[model samples]
Target chain A: MEVKNTKAYEVVIDSIKDMVFKRELKKGDKLPTERELAENLKVSRTSVREAIRALEIIGLVESKQGAGNYIKDDFATSLFEPLSVMFMLQESSPKDIFQLREVLELECCRLAAKNIKDYEMDRLLAIISEMKETDSEERSSILDKEFHNLITTTSRNKLIINVLNVVSKLIEISIKEYRSQIIDLFKNDRKLVEIHESIYLALRSRDEEKIIKAMEKHYTLIKQSVKM
Target chain B: MEVKNTKAYEVVIDSIKDMVFKRELKKGDKLPTERELAENLKVSRTSVREAIRALEIIGLVESKQGAGNYIKDDFATSLFEPLSVMFMLQESSPKDIFQLREVLELECCRLAAKNIKDYEMDRLLAIISEMKETDSEERSSILDKEFHNLITTTSRNKLIINVLNVVSKLIEISIKEYRSQIIDLFKNDRKLVEIHESIYLALRSRDEEKIIKAMEKHYTLIKQSVKM
Candidate 1:
């Protein structure tokens, strides 16, 4: 910021970050304007503006039209931005991404079994029935994502939900990339539908062990089917 | 990046992102120069420059001095930068952060037990001994982070290790923030050392169940002691 650093914008970014980390600046606290930050840090206003823009994109700070920049507390949304970017940048193997999703989704199923609300269970059943009726692979895949999303939402842990959102998105991409192979491996959609039904029944029963076993079998089948 | 958008730089950012995500531009692919991007997007060169800077910070692109910008493939480092910012932005409770770490670290312990090498076992012992010999809280915490870092590294799962790196860093911040309260709750450092020792012994014994039990006990003690 003082121009002592060649990367002036990075210096500005780090200065704000250090203040936040040290608790000098906190969530919802308003930051200095671009000009003020530049003057304070002895860098150009353009550098400060660019640094603030970077922070905004990553969900660290939010710009509310005329209200300037304020520190943000939306962890999930903040995480979602990078999580999306990570999906594009990292070419993870089908196995690696799906395996991670399997672990988190299993936990989701275990928790969903315990914490899912009645309305959520109804929704899950509706989705399953919808899946059973759909002949289109695309439609079924959409419902598959929704089903897993609902399970994660039902887990009731913000941390788990946030992390799983990222992992599951990557798995979605992997599935899409290998759709033909997956369909070829699992020729009978009935077995797939039955697996979902098993998970639904397990959730309805609120049995964690049964839920885990059901969810494990479900993903293990997918893992084997998409043997990339 | 056109002036049609109020945030011209944002348009430029989105354009590049869309290209990368759509696979028009790929890892190590060079981006248009600031002048060319500005012209292509009908945005000012300053806006284009700012957009590229933002992308560089996020690890989506790298500016190699005189070599222009190229897409980056280092997923974990890129994720780490935003993650540290998220840690500051989200004031997670000790329980929230530790719970996430427990989930991931438990997996780490399980995998480490299966995958840890003989040299890693020696290094694990060395770190624990360093912790035992240290009287300073700062030194102990450093060794503690190193110890957990090693466990995650031993897991041999890039996704797990990357995610744990971010979580453990937040936990480090949480511990530092609550250091006084934690020290007051557990004045005896010996118990802390013993817990780590139990984990190391279990890891050395190569019993996954024993490793998980010892690790769970260790985190449970901390969770109880912190009580936040």
Candidate 2:
């Protein structure tokens, strides 16, 4: 029966999932060849291949003409196909997306403060310094993205980082609208630089409360300033 | 240049996105034929079709071999592709996914409390009553889905509903695992039924705090009972 066959596939998928969760298999780790997997699981090669193909479509594995299938590390590309369509259908506004971003980025900031490595802190400081040197709004925007990307990376939660990355890309197409609305919020680039400095200090101190407060202040100010 | 052409296609996509967002066209609504769109937008049919094709991949529209493209009501199919891929790549645990579900469904419960219609409440109650009569685990699971679906519909936020629907599907596949845990924890169907009743009462009262509290209680119990 159709149901029985579906159940068989589900069992196959679950076994693979368990291995990944147990870390017996890891991200970017190559899975066994089809024949090997079938033999190990006592399933038909057809079932094993089907499960692998399904996982590939979902962005778990990449199969090339010659190269074996390799596990993917990043989650954003996997999310893009569905999220792009959802955003298109929902026609989510910049404001609505912004609200979601605020909730997520604030959490990221708090987590990064607690968990960011010294090297990451150095990189973040360098990015901020680079942003300070850039006079062009265009260059600054790119630097801004890098800054946020670093913060998200340090959050150490794949789901959060993936969702934030998708949201960032979706909003990138509308950056002009966002910029036009908030162009005058800062008196000069120095004020923006100063805010980043304060945030950096809070992060360096590993002060969770301070980090949350700083992030809230930064976002609230930006939101208010943009309204002008 | 390639850049210029991509920009033009983006413009076409944006215009259609605006129409959909503004509710000028809804799910199941037919779009103007490709030729009509080309004439109206002053773009080539090729450009229009390209944009539509991109949207189709994301699940906004469905084009039949003979029938024109129809707007899609549910975002499930569109969202599933990318999310499933992300799940596989991240190899997310049920706990991680459950955390997301908890946040999302709790939000849905709160929103439904404020917005659910009398008919919708009646439908939800009907499902619960039917679930009580059903001896089959499969039927009970179906009724459980309907209960959550009703709440999502009443939330009146398409974006939330779309995200929740995708999560719901993933959860459905794992419900047996979740149920066994809950059964182990509570050991009484009556207690489980009471939790749902309390949630339903919170909705009827339209008390946001009560809804949130009820959801927290329900999820906390679920978290304790379920094997993540």
Candidate 3:
């Protein structure tokens, strides 16, 4: 972000943020040119360049070589940056990530139970049967992710879905080996399938208490595999 | 981030992430020098600088003007960048944000009920009483944030606390005028204090069902004040 002075850099950043917050900047909108931004905000062209660079770094702004800066259409990509930084800093433990997932995934189950459509229920039923019949661990893990994702999507809350996806990815990344260790346990057991079946059944029944209980059981099983 | 080629820049970025994910780089650790990184990754020095700059803007790394880059100690500040951008893009509505908060705050209530300390409970009691006595809308709002923060902290989950803080800040920012509209409703109504009292009382009881019910009522009231 081309700044020798952090304070001036931050001031320019805040000015751009004010523009966005006030709705002067919008989705798919090109940022004002460095010269125009400098004149508008009373900052140097270098400072404006640094501000645009900062936004580009966060995945919020894209600097096309000749076309200039445009805000990205998708915003969720920016969430991953902070999370990765947190993981790198060891600010959060593997267990902390899992606990947050349990908190969120349970809510997903609750909301999904209330909001599931008929076709979605049929799809869930078919997935469960296929899960029960599958002997491949790779397929089972893929199905596991799908089942949870479908429930999260059914919650009908974009924020919840987005946060859960980020947390789940951290779970996969931060505890990469342990997750595989848990999946490996399935080679000798059918308990994974049973836990998911209970979750599906709980959702089908549309009982909030049962859904929470079932989801808690699912998390409990997974938590056992986590050493710390 | 300086780059003419997004593809090469992305590759450099991914390589740095891989280093962090694998724990090859760590907190407060300086990144490899430009030439070193370029040589090691078989990429250009410009690509390495772009990658470092990308990390720098995300608050993961701080580039000393004369020295080099080191990872930042605090990671949570980085989260606001994306949410603000998302709010600017209208990817998430104020309603979606509040819904997510409800999901999290209710879960926090459930966990806090199990884990809250006596000192914290005593503190909450004091705040609630002060909230009831205070006629100032501003004071009531401050107490409101305190009460919610205490419960979220007591949940004893770092990831949840960090994520909730980010969402709560977004609610304050994205719905700045709307939030004041709700707070303005508190001038003639003691309903805000009463709602918080129910939450505090439920926590004291440590009954999961009561806690959930009380928290639901709390959110129901707030959601009603929201125009959309």
The top-ranked prediction according to DockQ is 3
DockQ of each: 0.49, 0.15, 0.51
Listed per prediction, chain B TM-scores read 0.82, 0.71, 0.84
Please write out the lDDT profile of model 2 over residues A5-118, one tens digit for every residue.
444544556666666645677778887887777777777877676666556544566666576766776544533543654565567666556655666676678778767999
Residues A110-146 of candidate 1: C-alpha lDDT, one tens digit per residue: 7677789999999999999998899998898888778
**Interface RMSD values for all candidates:** 2.2, 6.2, 2.3
Screening candidate 2 with a backbone cut-off below 3 angstroms (N, C-alpha, C), the clashing residue pairs are A58-B85
lDDT accuracy of residue A171 in candidate 1: 61
TM-score comparison, 1 vs 2, better candidate = 1
Q: What does the lDDT read for residue B61 in candidate 2?
A: 71
C-alpha lDDT (0 to 100) for residue B96 of candidate 2: 52
lDDT of 3 by residue, A1-228 (tens): 344555665666777777786788888888877777787666688767766776776677888899998877666644455565565466577667777777788878888988899999988888889888987767877787788889989998777877775566575564445647776666553787788899999999999989988988877777776644
lDDT of 3 by residue, B79-109 (tens): 4465555654656777678777877888788
lDDT of 1 by residue, B94-168 (tens): 555766777778877887888899999999999999988988988887787788889988988777666665565
Docking model 2 quality class: incorrect
| Worst lDDT 10-window in candidate 1 chain B | B73-82
